[model samples]
Each structure stands twice: as C-alpha cells, then as structure tokens.
Target chain A: MTVETLLLVAAALFGIGVYGALSQQSFVMIMMGLELMLSGAILATGTLWAMAAGGTPKGQLLAIVLVTVMAVEMAIGFALVVNVYRIRKADITEKLKTLRG
Target chain B: MTDVLFWIMSGISVLSAWRVFRTDSMVRAAYWLMVSFAAVAVILVLLSAEFLGLVLLLMLAGEMTIMAVFMVMFMMNPAGLNPMTMVHQHRAAIAAGVLSFLGLGAVGVFGRFPAGVSFATRDVTARLGMELLNDSMLIFQTAGVTLLATMIGALAIASRRGRYGLADEDSIEPAVENSQNAGEGPPSTEKGSA
Candidate 1:
C-alpha cells in the first residue's frame, strides 16, 4: 500500500531472482531468473514513478526501456541457447566448459 | 478497497515468484513467473499506471508462453516426469538471496524518500503517448530498431542453415548445380550461390 511496502516486495522479488539465477543450471531457467530480477526492478521503478516522482512519464519511460531490455535479453538468450544446443548439444551451463566453437 | 487490493496483488506476486523456482515442471515454472508478473501488473495498476500496467500484462502473456514452449523444447524433463534437481550452489544461493533481501529491505524501510505526488489532471495514457512522441521519441525509436535487430539475429542464429552452410556441417560450399560446374568445388564468385 505504501511506497516502502512496495519497495520491500520488489526487493524480495529481486532476492528470489538472485537465488534462482545462481542456483539454476539450465540456461533457459537462468534466463527466467534474470527476467524475475528485471520484474522486480520494473516494479520498483513503477512505484517510484507513481508515488515519489510525481507520476512523471519519464519514470514510466524508464520502465518501458527495462521491458524492452527484457525482451532483447530473452530473444538473444534463447538464440544462443539454440546455437549452443546445436553446436555442442548442451543445455546445462556446466556442459559448456569452454567457449570455443 | 485499494489498499486491500494492493496487499493481495503484492502477496500473489511474491508467492508466485517464489513458486517459479520451486516448481518441478519447466512449463509450470514459466507460468508461475507469468502469474507473478501479472500480479505485479495489477499492482502497477493500483499505483495509477494504467497504461504501463496493461501493457505489462499483454507483453508477459506472449513472452511467458514463448518461455514455456522453449523450456519444453530444450529441456530434457520439461514435464517433470521424473524428479530432478537442476540447481547447484544451493547454500550459497540461499545466503545471497537472504542477504540481498535484507540489504534492500533495509534501504526501503530506512531510506528517506521524496514525497512528491502525481496530481495529474490529464489522462495518464494520453500523457504517456505525448511523452513518447515528444521527448522520448529517440528512445522509442531505438527500442524499436533494437527489437527488429533482435528478431533478425535470433532467426539467423536459430536457423539450421546460414549464408555459408549448415551449422553442423562445416562451411562447405554448396555443390555447383550447373551442368558445366557439376561435381566441381564451390565457385570463386561467392558462397551460397547454389
């Protein structure tokens, strides 16, 4: 309800995202973790925009940029995943011990 | 009423996000993430960002579906037919998660923040559109171009064949198809000139 409350929730979400990103072995799952982290960031920025920044469109614009970054990350992440799977038959991060080829 | 709705939506967001990694099935994990984002979208709506909130919901629907499909396609046990733990560094990760939460929560609770309120007399969506076209036009255009480039790059990377040759196969020139050049090595003209 309050700004602090929203920020707390965003922080919690970000923390969960960190845990997931560090723990997950699959590249896809790792990307999911990254997405979660961005989700938290977006929430925090949106909260600031709505409450602290006087609902300025600039804050919203920043949120939009973050979303765009998410999209680009997902697209390229999946593309590299497919490429890795094709080249080395790898989906797990451990399988990729070397970046060669 | 708004306060109650905010609490519920935030609770849903957090719980579903937690469930994203907890779930065994990859597709379930992806959808749980979708649910989490959707809840956050609702919270955004509660915060008076009607356009951004709705747009978030719309985008997540498609994005999460692609995530689910990719998980199924690329993962071995996509459906979680058998129990498998696909994680490492569990203790360290937990510690990091806790530490980050504590650190950020401290900031949220203790930090001094500005108290400016958005007393918008105009519609929020209309204002956003105006901002997009006026000051943020360059940023908007850049994002569009970036998305277009990402689409092309992803397609090129994911495709089995490229301009040169099949990915699995070394960059072998396509055998010359013309009768004069039949069975001959690739011409010196250029590659992919089959």
Candidate 2:
C-alpha cells in the first residue's frame, strides 16, 4: 500500500476514535477508542519507516517504543478507571461531573 | 495481491474499531477492540515490522481479556446478555467523526510524502536491542523508570486499600462477607446509596 493509503486509514480510525471518545459514557469504552486512534497512527508510522531505508534498526525501535507506550497507557487508564469506580460507585461521564469544577 | 490483503486488513481493523463503541455490552466492546488491534497487528506484519506486530497481537489479546474480567467484576452486565445503551451527544460525535475523515482524506490526497521502499527487517529486533543498550540506553532507562513509577502509582491507588477493596458498604456495615460481587451491579449492600 502507498503512504497515502496508510495515512487515509489512520485518519479514518482517528476520526472514529474521536467520536467514540467524545460520545461514550463509560471510561473503558473511551480507552478503547483511544487505542484505535493509536493503532491508526502506528500503522502510518510503521509503513513509512518500512518503506524507507530498511537497513537501520531505528524504525523498529520506534515501533517498539510506541507499543510500550500503548501498553503503559492502557494499564494506567484501567487503573484510574477502577479507582474511580471504587470511590464513586459510578463510571459514566455524566456521573463524573464532580471533577469538572 | 499485497494491496488486496492490505485493504482487507484495513477494513477489518476499521470495522472492528467502530463496533467497539456501537456494541451494547462492555465485554463485546473489549472483544471488538481486541479484534481491531489484531487486524492492525496483521497490517504491521505486512509492513514488515513482524516483531512489533506479533507482540501487539499477543499483548492486546491478553489485555482485552483482563479488561473483560474487569468488566465482569464491575459492570452491571458482564456477558452483554442485556441490551443497554450508555452514550451521550451522539449526533455531534457523528458529525465530528465525519468531518475528521473528510479533512484527513483531503490531506492524504493532496499532500506529497517522501517515498521509497526497502524490505530488510529480519534481524531488526536484534539490532534494535543493541542500539537501545549501547546508544539509546538513556531513553530505555527513563522509560523503564517511568513504567516502574506507573506500576507503583497504580498499586498505591488501586491496591493499597486491600485485595478485597474497601467498599463504602464495608465501612458502613463491616459485616458483609462479599468480596467481589461480579455477578451483580453496584452491590446489593450499597443499593441504599444510589
């Protein structure tokens, strides 16, 4: 696939994720949306790197780092959600209005 | 042939990702997200980043399963057996999604990207490790420390209270024997609070 195709897919996924993140009430669902956004970006980046000079390990390293970030972000997100649920007895965005102030 | 495979995988990833929010149940949402990630992994492998793609497939599967466990532990509907709707500002979200897609498509079509294709990646993982250890060790160390801090913070926030969790019900009654009321929602003992 060409770079344009990769980026187009990335943008579409990112858009879907933006919608989900904005519209979803549940924390976990929002996290899923964010993951989708990252997935798209990763695809574009990996494709770009792969299509370029494949002699160096820089591209692979970047992918590894991004994946690590994804894992860590997901872990932290779940932990935060669980903590909130523990305290508030709720997970809906509307119910989390106390944090707004 | 590769283009056909690319389109198929991209379609799968995008559709599954969209389904993640459309699904009524949390477990189904997680599974759909997992499928989306799995498809992305396939695309990454197709792009020649085999190691990263395979790792993502494995990790996302395990993580999504754990997320489902969390869903079962906390959500009112674990199996998605019940149809439940929990969303806000649906029309605005749809509009935003469509707009982004249009804008991005425009950019993709108009923008000039530097292009070339080199296909070497067999020993990339070994070289990646060497580079990390020898040249970019500082970055690796910093990330490791940050991850360590994240683990400690999560433990402090979620685990300090105890393995059973310090429910308000426990504080109020102090006699309830329930640890994980996963089969139910909001806990029966705390119904009065809601």
Candidate 3:
C-alpha cells in the first residue's frame, strides 16, 4: 500500500479510538481504545519506515520501543484498575468523581 | 496481487479495531484488538519488516490473553449476558471523530512530503541489535529502567501490605491459619461464569 493509504488508515483508527475513549465509561474500554489508537500510529510509522526510509532497522527500533512502552503502560493501567475495583467495586469513569473539586 | 492483500489486511485492521469498542464483552473486545494488531503485523511483514512484525504479533497475543483474564476477573459483567450500556456524549464524539479523520486524511493526501530516496538492504534485525547496543545504548537503558520501575511500582501499589509490613486491615481474604475456614480451593478454571 502507498504511504497515504497507511496514514489514512492510521488516522481513521485513531479517530475511532478517540470516540471510544470519550464515550465509554469503563476504564478498561478506554484503555482498549487507546491501544487501538497506538496500533494505528505504530502501523503508520512502520509503513513510513519501510516505504520512505527503505525499511531500515532504525525506524523499526522506534516501533519496538513504542510497542514495549504500550505494553508496560497497559499492564500498569490494569493493575491500578484492579485495585480500584477492589476498593470501590465500580469501574465506571463518570462515577469516579471523587477527585472533582 | 500484493496490493490486493494489503487492502484486505488494512480493511481487517481498521474494521476489527472499531469492533473492539463496539462489542459487548470486554474479553471479546480484547480479542478483537489482538486481531486488529495481528492484521497490522501482517501489513508490516508485507512492508518487509519481518522481525518487527513477528514481535508485534507475539507480544500482542500474549498481552491480550492476560487482558482477557483480567477483564473477567475485574469487570462486573464479564459474560455480558446482562444488557449494559456505559456511553456518554456519543453524538459529540462521533462528530469529533469524523472531523479529526477528515483533517488527517486531507493532510495525508494533499500534504507535500519530503523527497527522499530508498536504500537497498536486508537483515535489518541484526543491524538493529548492533546499533541499539552501540549507538542507541542510552535509549535502550532508559527503556530498561522504565520497564523495571513499572514492574516495581505496580506491585507495590497493588499489594495488600502497608509501609510497616502490616497486612491491610480491610483485606477480605482470611489469614493463613483461618484459610481452611474460607475453604473450597479457589473454584474452577473453566472459562466464563460459574
């Protein structure tokens, strides 16, 4: 596929993810949406690495780092979620207004 | 032919990604996310980044499995048998989504990109490892430290222990001596509701 096609797909995915994150009240759902957005970004970067830069390992390294960080972020997010669920017995984001001043 | 395959994979990726949020079951959503990432991995492989593509597939599959387990353990409605909806401001969200997509699509299609040349090479994984250890060692070290801190911080925050090594007073699980009274050996491993 062309670079434009890749970017377009990434853009669409990220847009959908934004919608998901904004509309959903569940924390896990929000994280899933965020993950989808990041996947789109990773795909676009990989495409650029392959097409624009002649598929160099340097660009791929960035993709690797992004993927690794995403995994770690999700793990920590879920751990926090579980602890919250343990105490609150709820995962709805809107109901979590305790921090609201 | 390869172009056709790319289109198909892209379709799968985008559609499955949207399905991730549209689905009822969180487990199903996580699996859909995995499928979407797998399609992207195939696209990367098609683009000649084979090692990165494979790593993406392997890491995402394992991560999604853990996510599925956590979804069931923590979510209130794991089976999704009950009708549930937790959405808000969906109309506004849809409008924003459409606007953002159009803006990005316009930029991608009409923007002037840098005129760059392509290089001819293979065996990129070995070159990547060499460069990472030699030239990019700092980035690698930072990533290592970040991962280590994440592990430690997550465990410390989630643990039921306090700063003074005392167990949490609110913990529901029985003490070691009283564990026999709690009984029943931690239930079945069979998937889905009891």
Report the lDDT of model 2 for residue B110: 81
lDDT of 1 by residue, A1-101 (tens): 77899999999999999999999999999998899899999999998888888887888999999999999999999999988887777889887766756
Candidate with top DockQ is: 2
Checking candidate 2 for backbone clashes, the offending pairs are none
Model 3, residue pairs in steric clash: none
Instruction: Show what share of the native A-B interface contacts model 1 retains.
Output: 0.72
Model 3, CA-based lDDT: 0.79
Model 1 Cα lDDT, one tens digit per residue, B1-194: 99999999999999999999988899999999999999999998888788888999999899999999999998998998898899999999999988998998898888878975754434888899999999999999999999999999999888898777787785322222333365565666766665
lDDT of each: 0.88, 0.77, 0.79
What are the per-residue Cα lDDT tens digits for candidate 2 across B2-45?
88999998999889888888777788889998888888899888
- Over A1-101, each residue of candidate 2 has an lDDT whose tens digit, in order, gives 87788778888888998898878877877777788778877776787677754536676667667777887888888887776776666676766655421
Model 2 chain B scores worst on lDDT over the 10 consecutive residues at B171-180
Candidate 1 clash pair list: none
Candidate 3 TM-score to native: 0.85
Tens digits of per-residue lDDT, candidate 3, B1-194, equal 88999999999988998888777788898999999999999988888778888989988888899888888876788777886777989899888777877887787788766535453257777887787898888887888888889899888767767687643455543233235544855445642455
Candidate 1 docking class: medium
The candidate, 1 or 2, that scores higher on DockQ is 2
Model 2 alpha-carbon drift over 4 Å, by segment: A52-55, B160-194
